[model samples]
Target: MSRGAEARQGLTLIGPPLFYALIMLAAPLAMVVTFSFWTQDYLDIDTTLTLDNYREAFSQPIYRVLLLRSIVISLVVTVTTVILAFPMAYFLSFKVKRRKTLWLFLITIPFWTSYLLRVFLWKVILGYNGVLNSALQGVGIIDEPLTFILYNANAVVITLAHAWAPFAILPIFVAMEKIDRSLLEAAEDLGDGPVRRFFRVTLPLAMPGVMAATIIVLIPTVGDFITPKLVGGTDGLMIANMIQVQIGRANNAPLGATLAIISMVVVSLIAVGIYLAGRKFGGRVE
Candidate 1:
């Protein structure tokens, strides 16, 4: 193809999606930004430019606390999910010599159900009169039901980790599968132990998938409100829950917009930091 024709074809391929993003994503984000600088009256929106929303968001202790808690929870969930998934992914990639597709299908069985239903199932499993407590009682393991398992930050982390497991596994598995087996054999021949081989060879090669999985889980988990809402009681409430309150019953859209923007900024910074750190570590490995 000629240069001009190629250019036109490229534009043709990208133009529709770019325009859609402009309309659906950029435009809405712009509106939220604009709204954040405005104020809301009793039943009307005061479009006058002001910084009160941001000032309140930063000055308020609750917002800061919730934002920090959300970050912590997200980090915990990401680490837990990645740790748990690595073994499973490793098994599937290296050890599972037969019926790999069946195991993978089973791994995705949870996804066939609604996300809300999964949350509710966890709630049922963790609640005071839930399955776990009942099972414990039935087995005579405890005289009383365990109240510490549900409706808290721990629950949030566990739920999110479970929910995001597949996301973490798939990328890591892909990365591990793509690794040349000869490198591992060569490392073994060189008198490297299994642990050393993994650290110096397998782990480094799998970093790309691990990084992708981390980013995928971290971003969404930080902003998740549903799991927190269903399983997270007062102490477990996250920034997203507060934002939802502001936009919902609180009738303070401006404040909600401000909080949302702040969250986006914080998440963006974290994602960038993680990417840079991973890149540096990967460079060291190389």
Candidate 2:
């Protein structure tokens, strides 16, 4: 086939899905961005492009606090999940010699149930007079149920970390799987101890997976509203919760769109920074 014909054929194959994606994803995003610049005039939208929404998003103390809290909660959840997941991923990749598929299947069992059900399960475990507290009382560990575990930021973090654990594990496991085993043997041959070998050879090569896991966990956790609503009481509420309130209860779509845009921008910048840092570190390792 001629190059022109090949190009046309490729376009024909790609065009339908590309158009569908633009309509489904790009159109809604563009509409939100456009709305963010306009104003809500009581019963009707003011259509006039203005920075009032953006200015309010920045200036308002409540918005600032919620945004900052969301970022902090997301960071904590990302770190907690990745740190816990790394050991499991490493074990799955290096220690398990058989039934690796079975172990992975077990790991994904949580996904079989509804996300809402999982959140509610955690609530039962963490609630006052619930499983954890009841077990503790039965064992004489504490005289009373603990109130701090649920209906707060701590509950939010624990739930989010659990929810995102699989995401963290899968990426890191894939990265570890791709690592050349000979490199570890070579490092050992060069008089390197196991710890030293892991740091110098295994860890560096696996950085791509770690970076992927971090981004995967970090981005969605920032915008999580349902988990917070179910378990995170007032102290645990995130910017997304506020966005929900604005759009639904307050009936202020423009302000809600502004908050959503600001969130996307901030998350995008953080994700980019992480990606660049990972690339730089990988380059140095090479």
- Show how many residue pairs clash in every candidate, following the order shown: 0, 0
lDDT by residue for model 2 over 6-26, one digit each (tens)? 999999999999999999999
Can you write out model 1's per-residue Cα lDDT over 1-286, one digit (the tens) per residue? 9999999999999999999999999999999999999999757999999999999999999999999999999999999999999999999999999998998888898899999999999999999999999999999999999988899998899889999999999999988988999999999999999999999988888888888899999999988999999999987899999999999999999999999999999988998888888777764321
**What are the clashing pairs of model 1?**
none
Using lDDT as the measure, the top candidate is 2
- Cα-lDDT of candidate 1: 0.92
Model 1 bad stretches (over 4 Å)? 284-286
Taking all chains together, the TM-score of candidate 2 against the true structure is 0.97
Question: What C-alpha lDDT, on a 0 to 100 scale, does residue 5 get in candidate 2?
Answer: 100
Each prediction's TM-score versus the true structure: 0.95, 0.97
